[model samples]
Target: MSKDFTYTINSIFFDENYRPSDGTRITTNFANLARGESRRENLRNALRMIDSRFNALANWDNIKRDRYSVELEIISVDIDIEGNGQHFPSIEMLKTNIIDHKAHKRIEGIVGNNFSSYVRDYDFSVLLLDHNKDLGAFSVPDGFGDLHGKLFKDFIASDSYQEKFNKSPVICLSVSDNKTYYRSENYHPVLGVEYLPNESSLTEQYFKKMGFEVRYFMPPNSVAPLAFYFFGDLLSDYTNIELIGTISTMETFQKIYRPEIYNANAVAGNHYRPDLKHPDYSLTQIVYDREERSQLAIKQGKFAEEYFIKPYRSVLEHWSENSAL
Candidate 1:
């Protein structure tokens, strides 16, 4: 895919009146900047944190504390799903373009995990929270995320995408604490042990339809494992700096979104497990209400169902029936 594959905000493509909920991906600091705040201090501070973190880790050359300069651009991408052969509104994305000093070029490109849906409110929150659902024997439909899967496939395969990006997009996700991932010998220098889950989760299955495979890697000196979705050799496809760019960015988000697990003040080790009820030490700089985030996801799912899903229920059902693999 040597074309300009620009990743548009698919979250808002399905709805015209869609507004980014307070709990969506992208830093809350950026959201404040979008709300007519003329001062750029907050945005500056957030960006500073990224650069600082990256500099502390980019110890390729000891003489230079900051070997690489990092900058983030919130690019707006408008991707059209050619499955419908039509146009939808452009989506807003807080895209992170990780640049390295040695390379002096863009190393890794990724969108933060929130505002995370190509279709306004995605199942990221609602369905994923099922990891905690105490309900016994509850079942999700086989076709549950087929629509998103199909739409995301077209989103990546679209002409606009091929023209805007040079490589397949990378998605960063978390390893569920409820599950245990056995460490494997296949490991890279930057990304530590490769952990394999007992089985694929529903989240992994649906993501596969969007042309992504899963990798469980906990970076060296990191506390826990993370679930990364992509289409190529995560270990060999990119340079160490490129991999670190993503690792640093995603870990920053996880530390903010899930401090209880990812952010503990202790010696980093692979066998570590977070005691959610009480961590040895977990501090949160930002206010991220997981409960509220999940609740809003339920609300958005209903909105999508009423506005987009039900109205085209028959068409969707037919698509699902014929497109099953």
Candidate 2:
């Protein structure tokens, strides 16, 4: 068997108003606001629709043994107009709105008590707030390092986070702007052992000892360019099996999916290897694991377009057959 590689998977969520030029909410016919429905109720119904779509696409039978699963954490927030002097409500306000009001609490409870609860069955979940200049006003309570840490410690630390996930996983959230959104070069560096010096090699050794095949991809260029090339090579190698990874835009996906047609490689820019001349240093190279790759593939827009759409198409085809019976 060929040596197995490790895949680092990441995902981001954009609200209805995600465009770069202006902060505006896009209207959708799918709005859940029915007569007499509270805003929270409407939000919950919309969330349920999203959850159903995600769950339908992530059916257990479709999960391959070689693939690792990671669920995209759903981020919930109201659209705020840019240049509004009003201090947008803090994360605390958001939480309070969900937890304090009886009706909102009930709506949240139905969705799952917290972010972790909402995604407990999967490996991990993250709740992200869109990046805005006024975000700092949404302060973290004292004694916590930052908003991210506080939310993780408080919400995820509850019983829900401790519950046994189908797989052991890590979760986190971030605020991003337009510049950081589309470019793989701007993607946050992989954390844990992957970034630690001499750690990649050690992790590979550990995995090898555990009876897993491991192959590291240590390109002589920067991580972003390497990532781009790696994905290209990966898709070519696994044409039979679907390949996945995250990108900022559908255009970006189209470019990578068919580089020959789009000339995305030209836009891919330069290759940069980490500046570690010393051989026996702290940083080490780790390969992409199959399971992680599978999850990454889905999150990165691969499965979203291909694997996910197929089941829905099939179900639509069979709907009349079942309904007539």
Candidate 3:
């Protein structure tokens, strides 16, 4: 087996002129939003959702008035396989910078775990089903997310990422609804109530493939807890302000993605699940198009199958059989 892999990063190949050099179809929420006559309105509504969530999270210091806000920018990452020079959109994330109204200062920014790729399908759709299992532990065959994980690590380790951002990534995901949570004494002022899951879920195991361990922290003023995935000390890797940038930005996306939980109007609890059809369910700020999200995942999976999986199946098999993370 060939023990060599190479790629290049093209961070500037997105936005209005996002045509991939190799005819690679980029599937992202932003890409979908950019496609129609209502592109402006779509983006505008997204901004409002983020602003509203940031305000809610920063309400602690807003007793008198709004004391904080978040500024966000879309960052796109494209990769050219084997150094072929054909850029393919790989992932997209948000660079969130906090605005301290009281201090009138713009704090340093952080790369938040935002919507981007097909991996979301494995976590949200595939693993979510595992949550409903009445009698089984979460599991997947070894090397399940190995290729995806490696590709992700490569992007983060690339010069383009280090030179531009120079910061570790922080991924935030929704807690499994079917599992019970126990509040621990572990807590941070910026990262709110810490909850321990009863047991590991498939989602946790999946992220571990990409060098991200999970921490469940329900930030102040949040209705429920969130699972934060990171490579280093969740407490020490970044300052409180940077962590706030992550919490505020990702919490907004979570609320939009899984409002049945984030907007449930409740705190961390054991075995809590929201009834979407129930009258008590709160009306979400924006109606997320679940079909769009899921279909994009399908398209991305097909893309990977055609371009990477089939051609390199034997190579991937060799690597997986002999290597372990």
Candidate 4:
């Protein structure tokens, strides 16, 4: 049976009203920059784009209407960057935006304090996409604007589908190029491969220790050595895990578990070097490389399956055992 996936898009910018300084505008012309829309509208449009992409990739016809339906929501959008020099907005900013926007009150049902904590100090955004509406809302600490305590209380008190998604395991995936300053000390630059397991590994372990079933996947050919780890109960409808980085890892995992989830491409070559003042290759080159890797995965087929199936299952079983109280 096809599994339902809910995908949400949280923009790094929250307030459409917030505009960059005139000198800081990167576009050739600042016409649109001056006519910025409301933050809510920008966020809604972003979510729509994300939904459209998912629809195209999954092929609406291939999706099982009864078992799979896609839902989109904006957890938060951060527009202000402060302190860390990171261009992304601060978590506090997101929290403030949500409260001001009254999103907590607008959501049908809210689960817990997770959303509140998301706007604290973390620099991430979460889009919870699952067949289960109960499990759709997620917040990342630094992803939003600001954390609002009173707003959180109001949200939890609201009627959102709180029970349905209570404590559902959330997994985060970070994909990057193999060559980057963040690589570990012993990382190999020549192979363009480094074992930088998912940034969420420690978090995944913490969830497992708390009795949630967790699984982590690292794309062997991932540009940044990407990793994906999931946390949740086994034997649930959400059994199919999606690995969206390297083709080799995707094929390997799919062969073993017949996972319904897979990536649209391989590791993004320049993903790690976003700061390059002037890229040597055109953006098209990066896109082509990603496509080639995906095609290769499709061609390799069963052989690729042989590599990932057994090991993947073994690791999952081990995680379950180790995590069980």
**Cα lDDT for residue 276, model 2?**
18
Off by over 4 Å in 1: 1-45, 74-94, 99-115, 118-136, 267-275, 319-325
TM-score of each: 0.75, 0.21, 0.77, 0.29
Q: Distance from true position, residue 306, model 2, in Å?
A: 42
Best by lDDT: 3
TM-score of candidate 3 on Cα atoms, chains taken together: 0.77
The clash count of every prediction, one per candidate, is 14, 20, 0, 30
Deviation of model 2 at 16, angstroms: 13
Error of 4 at 136 (Å): 42
Cα lDDT over the full model 4: 0.27
Q: Model 1 over residues 1-325: C-alpha lDDT tens digits? A: 2122234433322111223454343323234333223224433444555676667666767357666655454434543323443333333344455566665676545543322553435454454345348756656654566667765665566666666566666667777666657777787777777787877777788778777888988777777787888777766666666666667766766776677667877643445444555456576445445565556556665555565556556765665566533
Q: What is the lDDT of residue 307 in candidate 4?
A: 33
- On TM-score, the stronger of 1 and 2 is 1
Q: Write the per-residue lDDT of candidate 3 for residues 1-325, one digit (tens) a residue.
A: 1223443333332233333333333445445544456555555666666666666655666775367766766666665555556555566676777778888998866785664654444434443445446647754544566666766776667667777776788877788866777788887988988888888876687678777888888888887888889888989888876787777667766665666777666664544443443333365545456667667665666665566556666865665565443
- The residue-by-residue lDDT of candidate 2 on 1-325, one tens digit each, is 0011111111222223222111111111111122122434443433343333222333344443212221222223221112233211111100100111212322111111112111111111111222222575643223122222222233323343344222112111111111111222222222101111222332233223222232222111112222121211332332111111121111122222222322222222232223212132221111112344334322423222232223234542343233221
Instruction: Supply candidate 3's per-residue lDDT for 45.
Output: 68
**Tens-digit lDDT track for model 4 on 1-325?**
0011111224233233444432221111111222333434543443333333323333334353222212222243222212232222211111111111211232221111112122221212112112123645543333122123222222323233143244332333232222332344443221224443334433443334333333322233333333333334322423121111112222322221111122323343422332223233222100112234334333333222233223243642343344312
How does candidate 2 fare on TM-score?
0.21
The regions of model 3 sitting more than 4 angstroms off are 1-39, 55-64, 100-105, 118-139, 270-279, 312-325
